[model samples]
Target: MVMLDADPAGYVYRVLDGPLPEPSRGGLIRLVGVFEKVLPAISDEYASKYYTQARDLAALATEIEAMRDE
Candidate 1:
């Protein structure tokens, strides 16, 4: 989840280091669902940004699944 500081006039978000943290099973499911809806309407200008976010979410999911195999 993206978080921001509580400032009425300014915003500060939390940045993760290295890789995106894996969401819980339920959260991942929700992310996948949101992506399904968002991908179709993504325009060319923002495609690269959204594409990277989508890829990161997918990668996080994969990493989580792999950890379960251990």
Candidate 2:
């Protein structure tokens, strides 16, 4: 789950506890990339949300990397 600010400006929380379906990973990565690209241009409110989302994406990526390490 992902939560934005009260005004839907920035990202606040992201939770990834379960397995992600194969088909969704690509799209998810794409979305994360888009967010990373646009984050700097947005308002502080939006940037905040983007920051959290980006953090979540980074965490997810790290998890995947660790899986490959195994």
Q: Give the number of the best model, judged by lDDT.
A: 2
In terms of lDDT, model 1 sits at 0.43
Alpha-carbon lDDT, every model:
0.43, 0.49
Give the backbone clash total of model 2.
2
- Model 2 ranges with Cα > 4 A deviation: 1-17, 45-69
Q: Worst ten-residue run, lDDT, model 1?
A: 4-13
Q: For candidate 1, write residues 1-70 as lDDT tens digits.
A: 2211121011101122222245444444455565556656656766646554654555455455556658
Give per-residue CA lDDT, model 2, range 12-70, as digits (tens): 12224444455545545555665566566667895667566665655465466347548
